[model samples]
Target chain A: MKKFIEKIIQGLFTVSGFVTSIAILLIVLFLFTEGMGLFKNKLVEDGYQLVVNKQNDVSSLSAEQIKDIFDGEITNWNEIGGRNQEIILFRLNDISNYFTDEELGSELEFVPEKISELIAQHPEMIGFIPQQYIDNAFKGKVLEAGKIGFSDIFLGKEWIPTATPVSFYGILPLVTGTLWVSLVAILLALPFGLAAAIYLAEMANHKMRNILKPLIELLSGIPSVVYGFFGLIVIVPLVQKLFHLPVGETGLTGSIVLAIMALPTIITVSEDAMRNCPRSMREASLALGGSKWQTIYKIVIPYSISGITSAVVLGIGRAVGETMAVLMVTGNSAVIATSILQPLRTIPATIAAELGEAPDGGVHYQALFLLGIILFVITQIINSSVEYVSAKNKI
Target chain B: MNITLKKRRSQHLAFGIVSLLTYSIVAILIIILAFIIIRGIGVINWEFLSTAPTDGMTGGGIFPAIVGTCYLILGSAAFAFPVGIMSGIYMNEYAPKGKLVRFIRMMTNNLSGIPSIVFGLFGMALFVNKLSFGDSILAGSLTLALLSLPLVIRTTEEALKAIPYSFREGSYALGATKLQTIRRVTLPMALPNITTGLILAVGRVSGETAPILFTCAAYFLPQLPSGVLDQCMALPYHLYVLATSGTNMELQRPIAYGTALVLIMIVLLVNITATVVRRYFANKVKMN
Candidate 1:
């Protein structure tokens, strides 16, 4: 009977292992299918455009003339000096504009490529995009569509990714805010976390370590939304009074909150790595006439640099990927700031701020996905750095 | 002697800096806990727990969310643990040391790298809409199972790997079949670790919000879930709604804090219990 039961158990194990692999495969395949499905539909209505002739004839305009119309730094549609008619430009959601609510909704479902084609076919049409994608594709067909010429993105400093009252999805403010907040957070928390880690790993007695270590690790598991509310009620108010600001939910408040949120991750990972450091190295540094602080600074930090890097990256990931907490406190405004004290929005906060109202597959939706892709790329870069550093260390 | 005095002062400075640093971490933890406890003590009554949520957010109890959390956790475990343990077994026992094992190991590492939102998008595409689960508890539970799989496999594999190779060799020497020895000897000894891993998985699935946002969490469901396939209200989403949406700011403000405090308490309790359980087995093994 026992033999029979054992046979069944072994059979189950082999069977289930196969199933887990299948599940992961299915997940990857499904994303590709949904994302690619939009491209499968072919375009039939490759349309036409208006432009100025090289012969100085305004009636018969070329594609270049039409594109120049849209890219114009001109004040009026007529200021491209083209026709007497106000250039009643029409561009689709995909290439023409970041999607309006109606376009993102069921009213029109133009994939970005279709919009690109639409802009390509119409000379009076305008396309809003990076200058790189804008040229050649729509060069002969459409002009730069809006009144204000495309400004250098770094110089254009306002973000309103989901502004219903105003459609301003320029990400400059959000990008800056995310960086500013994360920079402040890492600056505040990293030193404190590393110091605590040093003490717990090297200096503290076993009982002191035992009581302290798990407590810190336990704190790591606490959710960010909790931290956000704690900040919303407590930190926001405290900062408001301290600074005498009109509102408490400023960038400074957001950073402090993120600092607290990032602390546990930095401490736990750094401490664990420190504890695992070779004992002989510490001894050698001490014997070299190095004081404890000098040894720690010169020897221990260099030894654990890879681990500390991982901790920093993880903390940054936590700060950047965080949505609900920062969203609640950063005043959810997408305006750029000159100082840390001003309220601002981050990319994640922008997404969380507007994802609910966004129509799926809309330009806004794609932009959000684009935001996801950007964030994924950034995190991937950080991760690659960790791997590169790890490989270099040979440890 | 003069050099010694200089060295001692530097040592004291290092100690001071380190002590100050540790005190900051401890101070933050104390402040957070104290704040939560002070507010939570006023909010967490038997009535608050037992009764259903009302029309307003502040007065309602979180019975449904709690029940939904339990239901999703149980469902996720039912789906994930068996398959995860099997994969671990395959790696440890049956699979030869080959390229396939190496590939599988790399894939597991890559699997951990995929962010929770990507998993959310995956769930949205595959389970929530494609499979027509339509934001039901089943979809949420299944996606969570997928999220839980890597953790379960990693932890279980480590646990199985830690078991002494001699025990398995002795079983083989007794003329036992590979399957027979694994079932009768290897599995029983590793059961404690498997339990510990499951406890950790529980904490993971309970707290995770990203995947379920697209698969499981309902924005407003006054009633409790009646079946596994039904839509559900979860704690994380409830907290999100109360905190983010301003339709009822007057009411939501207090509830958000109250819910957060409850969530922190529950997760802490669950984690501590799991740690205690792990230590129990570890000490027992040490004694033997």
Candidate 2:
């Protein structure tokens, strides 16, 4: 009986041991399965079609050109291989502008005919209308938009995932924004974190070290949303006032907040690494008449370089993975940020802000999942490198 | 002599810079804590803690969010603790030292490092959509459980590893089975550290927003959750909504501050408790 129970218990533990590995696999699997489904989706919004005048030369528009035309960046039809006429943007609602409500009827029964007429009348007009509004009898021709391809997402410029005619899923702005904020954060954090780590490792007395170490841990223990709150109330306004910007929420504010958040991880990890340096080395350096700082810079640092490198890698991972605090402070604008002073959005922030309203199993939802996959891959790379570095240090 | 003098001057400068940087970090912490306390203290009345939010979260209090967070904490703990402890036991006491163990360890590290938002997405896919749980406390708890699983496993493994081998050997000499040895000797010895880990996991789970945002968080449900399947308000998501997406930011700012204070206090309390538990256990171990 005892042996049987032990067998069951061992079996249970073995199963539990696989849980985390399985979870990691599942996360990747689910994200990819959901995210990769985006490629199978059409470039245009579901149930919507692009209609143009039959006389127009434009038969097709790539997702990029459609977004550009809609955004008014490509005002001339010739820019997209059409005739040398000005591109006129039209939405389903734009039909009202072309005709009176009485002519369209109260229930909008005649709206489709009116829409067909409007598109047919203006050769330069590109109309985005519902599929219900377009039939074989419609006067205009429908443009065939291809499935959303890899380049449309990876190389596209705009990130308007909810735009009516075409939802752009170009990750460039989010990718750039995420990298820019994380880079700035690392640049700001490394000096302070390294200095603080050095002070604690080399200079602080035992009592001071005890107090400061837990205090830093306490800082880490503070929930990130709380940090977001603090950032919104304090750093956002301060950044705006100092820079004379129109808005308080900017990439700089995010970087500053992330730097502060990353500081605890960097300080704790590097300080432990520095402290792990053998006392014998420091004593030998001192015996050679080297100063305390000299012993630190020459012996301790060199001895723990691998550990410190891992610490820095881990810090970068934290900054890149950080979501709530950056989301709250970074203004959540999906623009290609030109400077730290501009408001921008990161991958995590975009997912957090937009995932709620995205209809389940829709193109927008899958696009957000794709963003999640991108974020997951990036952080996994950073983390696996940290793991490798730390493992090497142990050896 | 000139070279030595210059080295000394440079050393002093570097020391000054390092100390300044160190103290400035502490100062920043102090400023954040002080600013939150000063601004948020006024809003934390008895009514604020006891009442449900009213009028689009502009007035009243954050009672439901607190309850929801508590439920999430409880539910996640219920799910994570047993599995985590078991996994830790397998790693430390049973699993042979090999590449499989190393791979498991690597996966744990990677899982812990994956962005929380990605976990949110995964949870949405697996629990909310695949499992058809809908937006519910159960789904949220499971999602948060996965997020904290790594922390729990690592801490449990560390705690179990700290137990001296001789204790297990002694139990085995008395004809105790492997499970018996662990249950009767090692687990008791490592209980305090395990408790500390569990408390820290609670702190982490309670504060998480992204995982719960899609999995369970309700925008405005003044009433408390009636079942595991019911969607509920969570404090972190509440603060996020009020701070960013609320209808009247000016009116809701105070409540947002109050909710933030409540969150900070919970985290602080958890940290202090874990520290005290660790210190008490350390002293006890020293006495032994």
Candidate 3:
């Protein structure tokens, strides 16, 4: 009976171990399932479609070309495989420009009628009006928006998830924005973090080490939302005042916040690795008439290079995955940022900001899930590489 | 002679610069903490701690948020601690050292590195939709449990590994079985360290905002959760909402600061307790 009871307890422990493994698997599976749903069919906006007068030869355009046309970058119809004529941009708001209040009626109730008439008269015009406004008697042609392809999702530059006619799920802006912020953050953190690690590992006395160690741990333990708040209140305004920007919350603010957050990880890991360098090496350097700084820079640091690399990688992982702070300070603009001073939105910030309002299983919803898949992939690569390098160093 | 003198000067400069950088970390921590505490202490009062929020979350107190965060921490602990501890024990004491053990360790490390937001997305997919739990406390707790599980497992494993092997061997020498020796000897010795792990997990679960945002966080719910299936307002999520997307951003700024202060205090308290417990245990081991 005692043996049987022991066996039962052992079995329970085994089962518990597998439970965690299964949970990780399920998370990866669910992300792909929902995210891949967006590519199954042609992308269409819920209540609006791009329409052109039938006399125009252009009947279809990719989401990218449509965006370019709307931005007035494509001014000629020939640019989008149509007849050589000047492309006319017509929108719902443009109705008032073309007709008077009396022509559109006192209440503008006949606005759709006038819109249909305007579309019927112009062959070079493309209008983005509501589907409800396109009555049965309307004579214009609706453009066939193609299915969202992998290139558009992976390589396209725009990140407008609420675009008319078709929501652009291109993640280039968000991906670059995330990378740009993380890059700047790591660059800012590395010098300070390495210097601090070197001091604490080799130079600090016992009292100094104890005081600094707990404070660094305390820094790491502070919740990320508090960091976000600090950035919003302190760093954001400081950047704005110094740079004289219209808004204080730019990618620079995000980089500063993330650098502060990533500091403790880099310092703690590198310090431990440096401390683990055998005492004999340090003594030998000093015996050979080497200064403490020279010994640290030339011997201890080179010996622990792999550990320091892992520390840097882990720091990058933290900056890349951070959500609340970046969301709070990066201004959440879904534009391709050209400078650190410009406002930009990150992928995690996009998911956090937009997922609450996106309807379940919709295009917007699936696209956000795809963003998660991308994030998971990036972090997994970084994490696995860290594990591999550290494991090799240990061996 | 000039080159040697220049090298000596450079080394001294490097030492000065590095020490200054190290000291600045402490200064930065103090500055951040002082800024929040000075701004936030005035907002904390009996009314603030005991009353639910009103006036679009710009007034009143954070009573409901406190309750909700407590519920989340308790719920996640209840789900995570037993499984994580058992897994650690199996890895340290029972499981054969082989490829399987290595695989489990790799998985745990990978899970730890996954972003918290990914966990949020997974929770929404599995708990809120697939299982039809909807947005509720249960969904949020399970999500947080997954997030903290890797930390708990690693800490427990380290604690178990630190226990002296002679204790287990002595119990076996007295005609005890493997199970009895581990249960009667090994676990007790590692209990304090395990408790430290639990404290760290609590610190993590209470402060996380992203994982709960989709699974359970309610925008304006100001009442105590009646059941695990009910929606609740968490402090981190509430602070995020007030600071970033509030109806009146300027008016809500004070409440945001107050919430941040409360969050920092809670996390720091847990961290300090963990450190003290760890020090006490280390000293006890040395004395023995």
Leading candidate by DockQ:
2
Taking all chains together, each candidate's TM-score versus the true structure is: 0.80, 0.94, 0.92
Per residue, candidate 1 scores C-alpha lDDT tens digits across B211-284 of 67767887777788888778887877777778777477877666666777778887788779878888899999
Off by over 4 Å in 3: A46-56, A68-79, A84-143, B1-8
Of the native A-B interface contacts, what share survives in model 2?
0.85
For each candidate, the DockQ is 0.48, 0.84, 0.76
Which pairs of residues collide in model 2?
Answer: none
TM-score of chain B of 2: 0.98
RMSD of each: 7.7, 2.5, 3.7
What lDDT tens digits, residue by residue, belong to model 1 across residues A107-175? 444443445555445544443333333334342333212322123223445444333211334567878
Give candidate 1's whole-model lDDT.
0.70
To one decimal place, how large is model 2's interface RMSD in Å?
0.9
lDDT of 3 by residue, B1-288 (tens): 886788799899999889788777778889999999999998888888888889988788898999999999999999899999999999899888888888898889889899999999999999999999999999999999999999888898899999889888899999999988878899889999999999999999999999999999998875678999999989999888888876788778888888988998998899899999999999998998
